[model samples]
Target chain A: MIQTLEQISTIAEMRVHIKEARRQGKTIGMVPTMGYLHEGHLSLARAAKENCDVVVMSIFVNPLQFGPNEDFERYPRDIERDRELARSAGVDFLFTPEVSEMYPKPMLTNVSVSHVTELLCGKSRPGHFDGVATVVTKLFQIVQPDYAFFGQKDAQQVAVVSQMVADLSMPVQIVPCPIVREADGLAMSSRNVYLTPEEREEALVLSRSLKQAEAWLYEGVALRDIQERMIAMISEMPLAAIEYVEVLRYPDLVPVEQPTPGESIIVALAVRFGKTRLIDNLITSI
Target chain B: MIQTLEQISTIAEMRVHIKEARRQGKTIGMVPTMGYLHEGHLSLARAAKENCDVVVMSIFVNPLQFGPNEDFERYPRDIERDRELARSAGVDFLFTPEVSEMYPKPMLTNVSVSHVTELLCGKSRPGHFDGVATVVTKLFQIVQPDYAFFGQKDAQQVAVVSQMVADLSMPVQIVPCPIVREADGLAMSSRNVYLTPEEREEALVLSRSLKQAEAWLYEGVALRDIQERMIAMISEMPLAAIEYVEVLRYPDLVPVEQPTPGESIIVALAVRFGKTRLIDNLITSI
Candidate 1:
């Protein structure tokens, strides 16, 4: 029988519930998120559910991942609404841990992956990947899922997380899912709620710039030219401040010096509109 | 039915065997060691056997934890003897992966615990705890055991590892076993095999010095006096070279400036005899 969506707030309860599921020979799939659910997050949930018998989603607004000046205090959170949305999406378990529960005392341990963390979004938001890596380490241990799903919108995150899992010999398979965007082309994000209508219109430029880069790649333009064109297109929008623009090799995140006749590379960008930072990217074989 | 000890040298094979054990509703206990059969290692295996339905001992001589100057190449290894001893001690599965298997590529991930790593052994061995923390993290993931056993002989190691597990919220219970010593009171270590017969006799000073501190504590000696007297005793042994002698509080390695009437503190010491460096410690209530 399919059970009702179960809410677990403590580590002990989550472990017990997961063990019971495992005993029944059920495969666990986890979707870790920060609680203000959107279609993108739901897509990750659906991907996990499709791949495994049980779906466990973590709803934690991790304080460690937020910078001192960032919106940690004001980050969106609505558990009642989130719970309803998670159930409607067929989530079997929702793990929502308090900050105190996640960090009873200050965390003294850090999990860091080198090289990839030194570029792009990492340059703008220092220590962000470290926080993400550490919390994800904790979540992986807490759930012990057979598979964990991540959205492709955060290209750097997928790369860094893949490095951690490989280096640590973690047994779970990290499956990357397609990014679910709005009908208009803007990427889905919890921070999207922070955007005003004008800000939202400007946010569309983040994806549009990537679309332009894709066209340039198809035309066999120089890698440098592609990067410059993408930057200029975003620069044309007064509200969008380009944090970084790079046409890079896939998986490794190394900058491609020149586009080869036919080579797979990731074109990634991060832009800020006022205080809200948005990131978007797509992979293409040029 | 009790099974004969099964040995695996690959991560894939070990995971499959462990999962099969878990499916039978057996709790797993892991004892990680470098290859060398000794009474100390056997004690860890016995402790795991007593508490768990299945005991897995991983014998990987992690090159990452050894400094270039330290004993990575010359570290004692006797897998045949280790296998025989492990079986007699009730280890059900022995995971002995190659160095290549553990690190097929240069590792890019590091798991480190701060504060606790700054004192005691960490001072002498730069990047040693980071190496230890990283490999232990890998071992824990590879085995995913219910309990991971450690010997209390390495007090600082126990403290640092406990910090990593707590900070990362790892699910395994870290079971610290009593320090198994030789009939003459020397702590058991694979490096003990490196001691020349004459140097082995001289190495007894490491434990003797700590025992001297215990007597001084009973005599109501001040902490400074106890430290000085222990140092003096080890210094008297011409072959024993004192690396460090610290009387510090438990959990945190803070120096106990003075001996209170009834406080527990760790009396840890490290000494070198020729090329072999040995360490030992005792915790006592004063």
Candidate 2:
């Protein structure tokens, strides 16, 4: 049976829970998410359970991480439903803190990684990574988990957090799990629920283009040629407005001219289906 | 008998000792200091012992915090003598990580606080506060203590760290102890060792003027009058080259015109005692 943490508002309450887990010699793993329990999030929870003795899942729809026009208000949250899913996924502790509970005052500090942060999602939303870095740092302090799991679907986010942890020498291991996808190869996202049937079909183009790019790389196609083909494929979808289709170095997420053998490569794209923006990525090692 | 943690060459080794203390349900307190420990450093350690179950003293003369032309190489270090003093002063762990251990690679990330960082020592040493903020952030992550102690001697450093912790929402409580002074009233600093016998005697002028300013404030003297008198006294000392003298808010260290009741006032001055620059402050509440 999984335990639900009731109003663990302060850092003190979180510490109490963490201390009890430590007393029992439990290795705690944390999966921090914005609450819309998609399979992608559940996959992270499952990975956490496999890696540690106890799994603490934090559901926080961080307003700071969302831009003014972004879907913060409409970001789907079903705590009761998510709780059941998390429990079934082997999460030992479910921590759901309110917005005011997490940020009592206006936040003044911002953590930013140079160079890498200027690409991908960062380009579309300014100050977004700063918000992500600040909130993640607060979460890390509150949870103090032995291992923190992040879905590789947020490929750029993984790169940013990795750079932050390494740069700050934070005392926790960051585990990036593989992205979970649907039967037709569309990456699982909580926003998928917002998709109309037509938008859902258009969203398929995101993964389809990524798959095409991956196959091209396997056949030793030029990096530029694959990128051009992905752009052409994404542009053809009537409902899809392509934000970016990029092939970059893994972990660092830097644009590479050619794929180096044994080096990880990431083919990532962002597409808007009507007003709803969705992101997906496929990482491979050549 | 006090348990001394000697021969900690790496940050990992130092973390192990602190983590073990935390595991035993003991609250850890840290007093971060450069080597050549004096009464001021001891006062912070004593305060830590009073409030926490374990006291860890870090003795790293952080080079990043010093300007290139400043005394990085010639900065005083008497580890053997400091170790004997730390052992006698009830310190549980003495963390003395080497330069290579602290900065293994070229540091790119720096923490900065807006507005408050632009005054006093920050104005004198360009990029000094950024360096201080970076090293302190690193120390906070490494120590992960319940409380970290700092002396009032470095008033600006205290203010900077406080702002950094508050802005970042760092988990540790910052415990600022009063500045410990010599019998003759000069503030204790490792750099005091650099002062000549003639210059050391002249350094007393810093404390004398601050005391005079405090007395004037008690007698309802105007803030401007107090500043003028203090500047005059410092100028009278042959070995003292006046840097800057001002009356400011306590802790925030911002320059203030008139003392606000219950808002503590700080009379601070910096003077070059021959080649060694020294700073001292006196706090008073209106």
Candidate 3:
């Protein structure tokens, strides 16, 4: 892979270019993203480059995924900087479709996955998963890549998308990359820019408490006690408003009443630092 | 394309065979059916033979599409006879996945299309289009055919599936096949076996009423009057229990109050002959 990255916008062009690459028997790996390049997004591009002959990165701030009150209009976007980063990261094709091109008319079709969507972030945001499922489905159809990558930072999103692909028998593989974090342990997110310096420092308590909870796992504390302890620790930071701090089973996202043999648990958190919400999780096996 | 027809029953084998066919640059066309082997199904296979290098016929009586009171158990099946019929129709591959193979687990994913699904058969059958969309989506993913064929006899079904493919941007093209009828004018259906010889003759009122309504469409009569006339005609046949006789806009399935200039209308009817329910429709551009 050279630095000769081709930028394709329209779905028609993307299909035509992909068909040519497919004719030549090139394997495709896609990293779907909302623009404004971050080190975490670049990490996805790196993984795709390593696995497949061609890497396509899509950068559209999907309106469908944003709630009415969420940051749809204020979401960060830098196409020029994104282009530079993608070129240096050895992206073969960059797809950046206009919103109108993506949805010219009112969308009447929706892809919904049950059971997996009724928990986590799906609890607070009513239609978030529906939007995510719908857009991710459209992207999968448009790209038709052999492998698609997502960040484990959004663990529930990964779970919902994986369920959709599996239940539908979609002919694509979903690759979950580990969450990238700051040196201070804050998970990298586009919304992190909304935090003040003081709020950012206070947000470190989220990871600190999670790491402490990881220690409690080996001690065989009850799941509720562990959750209460983490909640108490976060309450010390006045700037951090805890939305949810849950320790649930992996992939299924079901609440684990007690630790069992060979069971895996994910200690997940969602806390707001001023207006920005940050999420992070730590996985452990018992 | 050849005299030798191959039969596949598993998803793994189907993928392997289709991948190889696609690798050789063969355009595939699929005909999805419930496997009773009638002239209507043969028409789809013949159209597939004319358009594509390989024709695949999938025979699965999807239980998800049937209601609790509906006849799912006694739907009909004869693999040996269907194999011979598919072979005679020049099918390159016959996919007959077992129910367990198709639904190893309870399906958690559902694909839904709005507007088009709220009327016609959708009004009478709740969750019917949802099942159709879900199963059709799974088939499209498993086969990844270049084109898929459906009988226009189920005009509402064609509309639902077409909307789903368009909304999801699935890569396969949907081909609508013309409805093939018997010499006596009753529409060909797998459930027609349930009809007794005398009941079969009475069932002709379904097509007869629809054909009469088609004439009224060009005569500039109000759409409601045509629907009322169709209902009266079907009422005369005691064996034919009328379910619905609606004249609606094409694709959208919206009820039309009056005839519009140069607009397409679908004169649709659903009637039951004894225990079997039959549906038929005729489209005319006025």
Candidate 4:
């Protein structure tokens, strides 16, 4: 007999279950996602299941993280398919709260990280990381998980969250899972649904360019030269509109002229395939 | 045999003690203070002991909550005396982390509450509530108490902290204990150490004016007229420099021209006694 997955919508109901789980000595691992479940989110859920006695996945497309002109309204969401995917992945609990349920009134609290959030997507999107940090804090308080899993596809987000937990002395471990990619080498993203067929085909340039940059770095090419080459490669795709392409120190995200020996650095990029903006990154050690 | 109070000076050690307490099915109550324990601080500890199986009081002078020109450097501290007071007050654990221990590095994460903080002390001491909110968050995460006790003498601080816990869904109840006052009606404060004999004598005017305002309110006086009379009474004190005297709704701190019947309102004031700035408030329902 297959055990049915539990769907929790309210914070109070979720806490009741969490209290009982704690009483039974169950370790909870959580995977927070903005649903439209792709292979990447499933990978995070699978990672959680491996590490914890109970796996909780929260599918909330938080409006706090979106800019005024960004795709908050049209962001892809399919709870029906997401529930099926979560069930197949062996997720024990799925927390799917409505926007009103999560935020009953105007939220007056804001959680923000300073230096680490000053680079990457943070630089482009002004208050994005503040929004992410605030909502993630609320979820962490609600679930009180032992370990939380995040996809490295959103490298900056992982870094910001790691910094927040450390700085706040929050009592959970942050496990950064590897970026999950499609067979065609394109990084899996919920926004991929918005791409035209041609734009979808051209989107593979994002990853291919990063792969080439990784090879160049291994061959002892200067970091700036590799970054320039990667940008040039992606520019060749007609539909690709490059937002940023650069090499920065891992986690800290400070710009580097040369890779320090044995230190990890990330070659991350955000490029718009027509109207859909996609981000991908590769972390390699010198 | 008298039980000796355990003094925990490190986060790791505190966590270990808290974990052991949790395993034994203890309900922990916390009172966070900045040393120089007076009757006000002791009252909170007593309240905590009454409500919880274990009472933990933390006494660390938080520099974050002080402005550059504020009394951070000269703030009073006496751990030896504090330990004796904690023992007498029935506190089980006393956490006394050094500034370096609490903030090993420059903190990157800041927790801030908006709107409700914009009035009262928040208006005069900018970024003061943000610092208070951040440190309190760190303390709450470290202690993980079943209930947290706060003195209502710092009414705005209580409001800000209560708002943060509710907004963040933090799993601790905020218990606001009544303000412990001197026989002469001056509110107890650690900063009272900074008061000269003349200033100490003059400080009684603050509470006296509030009492007059309360009587006027009882007589169906308008809120604005009561505020003007209170300000005038305080102005008569030769050494007093009034920062603000406000008549606002309780908890929310929104300005109110007149109190709604059956609703609580606060008549709050901040004044400088020579170099020492002190705050006090009276909350009553119409």
Predictions ranked by TM-score, top down? 4, 3, 1, 2
Docking class of 3: high
Evaluation by lDDT, superior candidate among 3 and 4 = 4
Model 1, range A167-278, lDDT digits (tens) per residue?
Answer: 9999899998888899999999889988888989978888888888888888888889988888888998888888899888877788867767566689998888988888
Better of 1 and 4 by lDDT: 4
TM-score between model 4 and native: 0.98
- Tens digit of per-residue lDDT, candidate 2, span B1-286: 5466464667888878877876787898998888799888888888888899988889998888889889989999999999888877778788898888888866645666656667677788887887788778788888888899998878888888887787666778998888888899888989999989999888888888888888899999998889898888889888778878878887777777787789988787778977798988877798
Using all chains and alpha carbons, the TM-scores for the candidates as numbered come to 0.97, 0.92, 0.98, 0.98
Model 1 bad stretches (over 4 Å):
A1-3, A259-263, B1-3, B259-263
Cα misplacement distance, residue B232 of candidate 3 (Å): 0.8
For all the models shown, what interface RMSD does each have? 0.7, 2.0, 0.9, 0.7
> Which pairs of residues have clashing backbones in candidate 3?
none
Which residue pairs show backbone clashes in model 2? none
DockQ head-to-head 1 vs 2, winner: 1
TM-score of chain A of each: 0.96, 0.96, 0.97, 0.98
Cα lDDT tens digits, model 4, B1-286, are 6957999999999999988887777899999999999999999999999999999999988989999999999888889999999999999999999999999989999999999999889999999999999999999889989899999999999999999999899989999999999999999999998999999999999999989989998899998998889899999999999999999999899987788899898999999989999999999987
DockQ of model 3, rounded to 2 decimals: 0.83
- The C-alpha stretches of model 3 lying farther than 4 A from their native spots are none
Error of 3 at B102 (Å): 1.4
Model 2 residue A225 CA deviation (Å) reads 2.6
